[model samples]
Target: MQTTSTYKILVVDDDPDIVELLHYNLTKEGYEVEQAENGKKAIDTAVAFKPDVILMDVMMPVLDGIAACRQLREMPEFRQTHIIFLTARAEEFSEVAAFEAGADDFITKPIKPRALLSRLAAYARRDAQQEGLDEVIEIAGLRIDRTSYAVYKGDEKIILPKKEFELLAFLAAKPNKVFSRDELLNNVWGTDVYVIARTVDVHIRKVREKIGEEYIRTIKGVGYKFNTD
Candidate 1:
């Protein structure tokens, strides 16, 4: 994840060996990293460290990652912070629990360092883009103010998650221009991140629901476009 020092990462796990391994690797990759032995410590360290991402384990001594994730999501400061459950649990139920706890991503244990770095890079890219959006775009009655990171449908404001907002902004940047799934994934999700094309459709659906069904047009056999008419 060769990132700048400005981007911090907090690794939470009860195993000393795992913590050392992750700490050493993340530091070697140029990211400022911190560690917590359990979920309780994870929350404290996260608040003080103000990390950009958190790699947490499902099982810990004091508290579990699922519970920690849920608590962090309730805090406004951690709402957009990317939390990835890096645990050995691979069961379907475990995956469900992780998402239900407000996890942004999940990874099974025994992952290679390079693969882990790739996954984290996707999040860093998305975060950077969200913070960098500076233009205020208005199409028809919909207003996107990048400065405040807010969207307005006429006088009514709409709140969207990081991904949904990014997808909406990308299409609205050039209204009526068609962009294929691959193009959207590359531009919004980052080309380095390997996400399925269907992910775009999911985000598009959410954006349409929040902003209005008439704002985004899905072109069959192609991709999607932002529409004002």
Candidate 2:
């Protein structure tokens, strides 16, 4: 039900020109846009603006994007927010760090406005679909709540970033069914988003780290399945 005009976007970059460029383009697309010059300012702005999507550069004054993302992920309010790293850094380790810090997507920047707009539109569509799902999966002392995006192991609460939570919930929902990396990508990340197969591995490992490794089993030559037993 939410349109592009209703989606709030926070664009963070130390480069004045890049910030201005994105602000101009995003506003022209009908999104409510805000800008921050650095990661510290980004957090302050996000607290006030509460943007649904954040487009942040990796290197910035005071705090870097990875640290800012980690700090944001620690807050319950930003748990479901889409944090996409828009940076020039294309190194594998940088990408890994961004994901570890809870980024939903990573874009290497020459700043392709059209591609960026397409991705944002994909996010909007995904958000609308997710809003219709309100179910809980409880098995093996783990409780996955789609409504509140909360997970619990026994009585202790576990906070998972949006992607990791969705991965876990997807596997658990179909307990004992094996899902290939590609299948998980299409179902969880959606066909509109381009993510590498290894991203699925990264998310699965993070989920296991939080919820315990016992629930999800790697099927040697195949993919992964929830261990109901």
Candidate 3:
């Protein structure tokens, strides 16, 4: 079992058995675990607990997981929080809906302890990697402050969505290094996230539109490279 004493996790599910199982396993793994029987309670608990990760069930009383995720994403405090959905429905559309609703990842029903632990480990690694990154990065007339979550092109401040800002910062940290879409997805979205490769392309296009095309170069049949020159 991994020790995640510093991290807080909220488990939301109407199933008492599932909630008990998660709470017990998570607590045994050294995490500070909290539980809510429904999405409404989850939201209330999240507001007070400020958990690092939320394991939410799709079907529940009052509010559903997708709706709860959307609500949390709208808040600035939870903009970067990881929300992983637990769904029994294996339909492709169901998964798509969860992603569209701002879920970061998903766990299929009858969650295995090992698989759940693996996902949690991935999140921990991502969080540690981000904590080690330099708070401020300046290069090629671009200034990025990870602390304030701000970006600047020369003297002008630019507003970017959370993912776009993270994507740009990840590339700018090592200018001239070509990064494959898989690398970008793993670093920015975490390895457990099940997003298509086109997701990276979409973000890249948005970033280019906002910051000009000169900053990022697309290598056909290869990947993308950040060009300082």
Per lDDT, the best of the predicted structures is: 2
Error of 1 at 48 (Å): 3.2
CA error at residue 41 for candidate 3, angstroms:
2.3
Worst 10 residues of 3 by lDDT: 191-200
What's the C-alpha lDDT at position 133 in model 3?
Answer: 88
Over the full model, what C-alpha lDDT does candidate 3 score relative to the true structure? 0.84
Candidate number achieving the greatest TM-score relative to the actual structure: 2
User: All candidates' lDDT scores?
Assistant: 0.81, 0.90, 0.84
lDDT of 3 by residue, 23-130 (tens): 889888888988998899999999999998899999899999999988987787887787889979867677767766767677789988778988889877766677
Candidate 3 wrong stretches, greater than 4 Å:
1-3, 139-142, 152-164, 189-221, 225-229
Off by over 4 Å in 1: 1-3, 14-16, 37-41, 58-74, 87-106, 118-134
Work out candidate 2's RMSD over C-alphas: 1.4
The residue-by-residue lDDT of candidate 1 on 1-229, one tens digit each, is 3246667999998888888888888899888999999999999999999998899999888889999998997786886677888889887678767765766666887867888888887777666666666578887787897755579987787766555777888899889999999999888867666545666776787677777899889899998999866
Report the error of model 2 at residue 213, Å: 1.1
Expressed as tens digits, the lDDT of each residue in 1-229 for candidate 2 is: 5799999999999999998889999999999999998899999999999999999999998999999999999989999899999889888888888888999999988888998999999888877787777578888788899877889887898888889988998898889999999999898888978777778889999998888889999998789999987
Candidate 2, 55: how far from true, in Å?
Answer: 0.4
